[model samples]
Target chain A: MDEVKIIEIKKSVFADNVKDADALRAELKEKKVFLLNLMSSPGSGKTTTLIQLINRIKDKTRISVMEADIDSDVDAVKIKESTGVSSIQLHTGGMCHLDAEMTRQGLDNLDLEETDLVILENVGNLVCPAEFDTGATCNAMILSVPEGDDKPLKYPLMFTVCDLVIINKMDVVPYFDFDLERCKKYIHLRNPQAQIIPISAKTGFGLDHLADWLLKQLP
Target chain B: MHELGIVFYIIRDVKKVAEENRVERVSEVVMDIGEVSTVVPHLLTHCWRWAADKEELLKGSELKCNIIPAVTWCDDCKQEYETVKHGKTCPHCHSENTWLLRGNEVEIRELVVSG
Candidate 1:
C-alpha cells in the first residue's frame, strides 16, 4: 500500500479578515474617524433608527453612512434621499454578511478622511454580521420590540460582540409581549458590558442619547 | 446565508497557500468549523463544491468540515461548560464572570495535497 502524504497547513479561514480589520481600524484611528458597525435582523428598524439618528446629528457632525445589502440599493437610496448625508451602497452580490475587506472597500471609495463618523449599516443579519469584525471602532446592534425577547438567546454572538444594544420600536413595546427587563437581562447575560438603550425610531424617543453617544466616541 | 462568499474566501486562501508551497493540485481542504460559529457547515460545503470545481488548482477538491463543540470557561468556578446548553452564565456556580474559550473557530486546520 502506497501511503499518501498528508501535509499539515494550519491556517485560519478568517485570519486574513482579522488582519484586514485590524489594519483598517488602525487606519481609521489615524485618520480620526470613528467607524460604527450596525447590525440587526431585517425589519428590525435598523434603517429607520439610522435615518432618525442621521437627521439628529448629521448637522453638527461631518458623518456619512455605508449601506450594505445582499442585493437591494433601496436602503442606500433612502439614506441619501431622506437624510441627505453622503451615502454609498455596497451590494454583497448575494452574500448576507459584510466582512472587513468588504467594509474597507466601501470606506475607501466613500472618502472618510474628512468625515467624523462612518456608519456601516451591515447587511441585515444578526447571525453572520457578528462573526466578522468590519473594522469598526464600536459595534452596535438593533433589537426591535416586535422581534421578541428570545433573540439574544437565539443569537448570542451578535449580542455578545456588540458594545451597545438599541431596543428599537419602543412605542410598540406595549403591544408586543416582549418583556423589556427580561430582554435586558438576556443581553446582559451574554454581554455585561453592553449598554442597552431603549429607543423608538417612529416616535423619535432615544435618538438624542444615541447621537450623543456617537459624538462621545469620536476621538 | 453568505456561505458562497465564505467559499470565495476559502478558495482565495487555499490558492494562496498552495502557490506559496508550490503545489500543483490540491486534493482536500479541511476546515475547523465551530458549532456556534456563524458559517453553516453544510452551506459552506455546497458553496465550496460549486466554486472549487471552477478553480484549476482546486478542481474536484474535497472540502471537509470538522465540527468543534463550543465551550465556555467559568472564571468563578474555574471549570468549562457547554456553551450551547448553559448559555453565558455558568450553571455550576451561576457566575457572570464566564467567557468563551473555544468553539468559535473558522479556520482551515489542514490541507491534503499530492504531487
Candidate 2:
C-alpha cells in the first residue's frame, strides 16, 4: 500500500484573493486609475444611476465603465450610448460575483492610460459580491426604497463592506414606507463611517452629491 | 453557484501546495467551515466533485468539511453564547452589544496525499 501523509496547510480561501486584490490596487495606483466597484440588488436602478452620474462627471474627468453580469451586453451598450464613454461587458459565466483576477481581466480589456476612473458595476448580488474584493479603489452600493430600510440589518456583510450607500428611489418615498432616518441608522449600525447619499435616479435628484463623491475619490 | 467559485479557489491553492511539496496526487482535502461563513458544506462538496474531477491532482480526492460552531461575545455581560441561537443579542443579559468571536472561517486545514 502507498504511504499516506497529511500535510498541514491552514489558510483561508480568501487569502489569495486578498493578496491579488492588494497587488491590483497597487498597480492601479501606479497607473493613476481610480476603480470604483458598484454593487446592489437587481432592479435597484444601478444602470440608470450610473448613466446619470457618469453623464454628470464625464466632462470633468475621463471615465469608462465595465458592466459585469451573468450574461448580457445590454448594460454596456446602454452606458456607451447614454454617456458616450467607452464601456465593456463582462460575463461571469454563471458566477455570482467577480473576484480580483476577473476584475483585472476586465481592466486589461480597457484603455486605462486614457481613463481617470473606471466604474465596475458588479453582478447584481448583495451576498457573493461582498465576499470577494475586486481590487477597486473604493466600494459602493445602492439600496433602493422599495427594497426596504431593513436591508442593512439583513445583509450585514454587504453594509459593512461598502464605503458609500446610495439610497435610490427617494422620489417614491411618499408612496413607500421607507424611513430615511431609520435606514441611515441601520446602515450606521453595520458601518458607522459609511457615507449615505439619498438620491432619486428617476428624477436625477441628489446626483450632484454622488458625482462629487466620485470626483473626490479619483486618484 | 457561490460554492463553485470557492471550489475553484480551493483547487488553485491545493495545486500550489502540491507543487511546492513535489506531491503528484492529492487524496483528501480537509476544510474548516464556520457555521455563519455563508458557505453550505454540502454545496461545497457537490461543487468540489465537479471541479476537482477536472483537475489532475485533485481528481478522485475527497473534500471534507469540519464545521466550527458560531459563538458570540457580549461586551456588556462579558459572556459567550451560541450565535445561531441568540444572534446579535446576548441571551444571558439581553444586551445588543455583541459580536462574533469565531465561526466565520472558510479555511483549508490540511491535504492528504499518497506517497
Question: Who wins the DockQ comparison?
Answer: 2
Top TM-score model? 2
Per-residue lDDT of model 2, residues A28-117, tens digit only: 999999999999999999999999998899999999899999998999999999989999999999999999999999999999889999
DockQ of 2: 0.79
Model 1 residue pairs with clashes? none
For candidate 2, the docking band is medium
Candidate 1: segments with Cα more than 4 A from true spot: A1-4
Write down the lDDT that model 2 would get. 0.94
Interface RMSD of 2: 1.1
**Clashes per model (N, Cα, C within 3 A):** 0, 0
The per-residue C-alpha lDDT of model 1 at residue A12 equals 74
Candidate 1 lDDT over B35-109, as tens digits, reads 877779998999899999999988999999999999999999899999889877799999878888988888888
Output the number of the lDDT-best candidate: 2
lDDT values, one for every candidate: 0.88, 0.94
Candidate 2 residue spans exceeding 4 A from truth: B92-97
- Complex DockQ per candidate: 0.64, 0.79
